[model samples]
Target chain A: MEMEKLYRMHSDRVYSYIYLLVRHRECAEDLTQETFYKAYKGLEAFNKQASTATWLLKIARNVTYDYFRRKRVIKFFSFDKGHDLETNALSPESRYEQKEQLARMFATLSKLKKDYQEVLLLRKIQECSIQETAFILGWTEAKVKMKMTRALEALKKEFHKEGGHPNGTIKRI
Target chain B: MEPSKEFDELFEEMKEVERSEEAKRNTWLALKGRIATKRKRNIFPAFISLAIVAIATFLIITYSIPSETEQSAESLSNEEIIRAVLEREYNGPDKEHLRLMNDWMKFQSERNAKNQEEYDELLESKEYKDFMNYYQTTFGEYFTENMLTKAISTVMVFKYHYYLEDTDIEMHLENVEIKQEKDHPNIYRPIIEVSLTNSQGQKIFHTLREEFIFSKSEPGKIGSYNVAKGGGSIEFREKIENFNSYVGGNEDVRTPSFRKTISFDTLCFNGKIFENENTQKNIHGCTSDRKKINSILKIFDHLPIKEATEQESRKRAEALPQMDNYQIYLTNEVDKGTTFYTITLYEDGVLMFAPGLDLGILGDITTAPHAVIYEKVKLMLDEFSDN
Candidate 1:
């Protein structure tokens, strides 16, 4: 595909994946650019084996992981206070309840193992098909299915621990 | 088994997370520019490598052949053959010269290989990767990729002053907020809070929120949007305090205390302007233009004076090249209590105003205003030459 068309088709999914991984707007934006730049440079290496979106997301995932490795020391000491502040959607008073519930769920998700978080985000949140998730993650379709099952169970346990019912409603303890 | 409703709701919220339209546009522009530059740069290296190979081939051909005199005289050593050839071609050929040439070539080849390895490693380095990522995110469509890289040796903090139709504005990274849209799950908005200080010293602040929608699927592409301005306020002092506290405990933070203020009655411009210094010209006495002092003073007055963080001061000290014998002197009456301040002008046209007594304060006059001052000074000097 032409670079422009490729960018138009997949940039958002790529960017959102990076954002979910890094949880920083500036960092996510940077990683997204890096992913595309890498895609552009490595375009010759890209075979038609997987869809373009999966390839882009794979690059995005690697870029974000590279960032995490670089920032591991800083991350250990500092809680990312800026992550929750990134979303401007809940500024309205009416959406406060929903926003709080989402925040709680996100908090639970964030505490999960990195791989679990990745599996759930790709399978459930991004709503990627098992094959696409496998392609992007460089995993087998069977592994993605197994991981998704385990991730969903882990998320449910964490949510319940956080006073959330299995139905997804939050109960303030 | 079906995914629970709670998981679905959470996933639904995650689906709403996306790149703003403005961000998408900016990233596309940045990516396009980067790709173009990469193409151009790639071409140049190919040409360079080709030229290098051709030159190496020519050198090998020319240097490998033994001369008739050497062949007739005796079977000479490689060093002796080189010496004889040098002596015949030029005047002097010492044993040391052949050794030096061999050593230099060996050094050059080794250095070249080392440098190539380092460059390759740097391409894969985390710092370089982060730099590429940050460059696109921080500047976006506002700055070209090459502009950020022109001076790789120097640490430059770019402050963009955007001129709207009626209002002039400046935004720091601290004031920007990015969030998902509540009503539309697939959209994200980046709202920048702008604090405008009017002539009366009263501050009027407003939020410039993005109006365009962005889809979660293609978060990098920003759609068209008008800025919705809303009422807000900026607490400048509080922000400064917070910044100071953040960097306070670190020894690298050079928190210079305020020293006594100095007043100057006269200014002098000296050193090489075009080629060499014509003469030491006094701005107060040389120029017949009555507004000369005020014009110069206007530039000084508008300098962005602020307490320099330790990181900024250190970066400035390291990055700035050694200045030539350039000096701008300010003097006042002895009884009137005069102060002399030193201003460092960078090759890139950034001026750092460092007051006397080693005041921890550093004033930065960005390139635009610094250019204005430089032009004004040159014009004043040209007037002197005309006479």
Candidate 2:
């Protein structure tokens, strides 16, 4: 029961973070499960300096990074999964605009370099602190800031130069 | 710490990416099954029984006896403090009074010069009395016996104020920083960036950095709240929460480790790269060849640089590079990492692209007081440019 509760509390964030890296839902799910398995094994040594969520993210990042390091092959991660959760907007038109903007945002995000994508996702989207981001990426805090500045510039430039969305919508899993 | 305002909306949407319930359930079930197979908490039943008994005994011993002192809010973790603030159970009236006090501060400061006599006069003034009466009437239930300490119910406005009564507030806390003033061990300055919006077609902002000092004597009360710009109100620094502290939690939380200060680092431009706002960095990669670059830039060192007028400085600092200019970026690798800054050289002046800002120059002409008049900056670029 305790394990299920912990998974329920944190699985989505872990999955989403992994998904952001892999851009594949099934693969992200598998990796997330792997991350938990690893985390459970190491649970006895968990440090309390950071929050449980931050610790999980740190683990998830390593699990994902290790997967890439082992695979070394860049799969063409197209945004072909076309499903979105219902928007809470009162107006249908606003909801559609919100959905389209989100789609456009994700599409633009996909175009950046993988490191840029991770920096943007972790810092800007996930809203981690410089310290927390450093902890997750295993980079120094200054590196995180520098990467964030560069990543924001690249993302902004890409956002301005963004054209049609050839990659289909995100399924939001 | 944040992208510019335009990205805030998109980030808000992106953060709403929810794992579908189906996927979450499947992942959870799969993880649970695998974990059960791997460990199953082997030999844990007796240990679990011991832990439960110990916990129950500890709880009974801790909470059963009547204690003279209540727990201090300082003992709560940052998460608990935020959660307590969000609970709205005891904080509704407390926060509302804080708003009242903040508005009163604004009103009083606007009306009078911020001297002690003026403050005392304001306190006796009819407006002050009316404000006091309004606070008492609205929040008397929380602090009927005591009138001085405003946040008796817990929670204070801190470094910045919110016009809470003017609008309904929906808040999301992103981070917490625990700052301490030296020699005052009991004072905690917990800073947080809060995203606030109003439900009633009112003023809304994306986020705000609010820092408030929590006193051990009286938790959730205002101190050093002089947010009014240019207002040197001495009374603003007065400890407003001198009342008794009350909460129920652990007694010795020991002021959750002081926030980490970013160590001063060896940086480029004699640490000029560190001046960019919003980030405290420890970078080691100064361009080893800067002496070579600066030697080429020696002409401007002899120019009647400081004689330039404010207009000239402004124009040169902000002006676009002349058409006759040479352009090159002096890249200083940050911490030997891929992140580096580019310093631009023009025929007339030098422009260093300020990191953490959009296409603006802050430390121009090598952060010189005057703009460049000589071609030596371009010569400096020429000495190094690939072209």
Best by DockQ: 1
- Model 1, span A56-105: residue lDDT tens: 88888787778877877212111256645335555555265565677777
Tens-digit lDDT track for model 1 on B1-387? 354454785577667665689988888878877864674334212212333334434544455454453342234432232233222212212233234334434443454422234434433433333333332333222222332232111212111111211232222221333455677744545544334343333232233344434323334322233333431112322322243332233333232222235545555444333333444332222333436655655545533344456776776666443322233445554422343665554433345566652222255323221333444445554454422
lDDT of each: 0.50, 0.48
Task: Going through the candidates in order, state the TM-score of chain A alone for each one.
Answer: 0.85, 0.76
Residue B125: error of model 2 in Å? 74
The alpha-carbon deviation from the true structure for residue A146 of candidate 2, after best TM-score superposition, in angstroms, is 1.6
> Which runs in model 1 stand beyond 4 Å of their true positions?
A73-94, A166-168, B1-6, B44-387
Residue B86 displacement in candidate 2 (angstroms):
60
Cα deviation of B265, candidate 2, in Å: 81
- Misplaced by over 4 Å in model 2 are A69-71, A74-78, A82-85, A88-96, A163-173, B1-3, B40-387
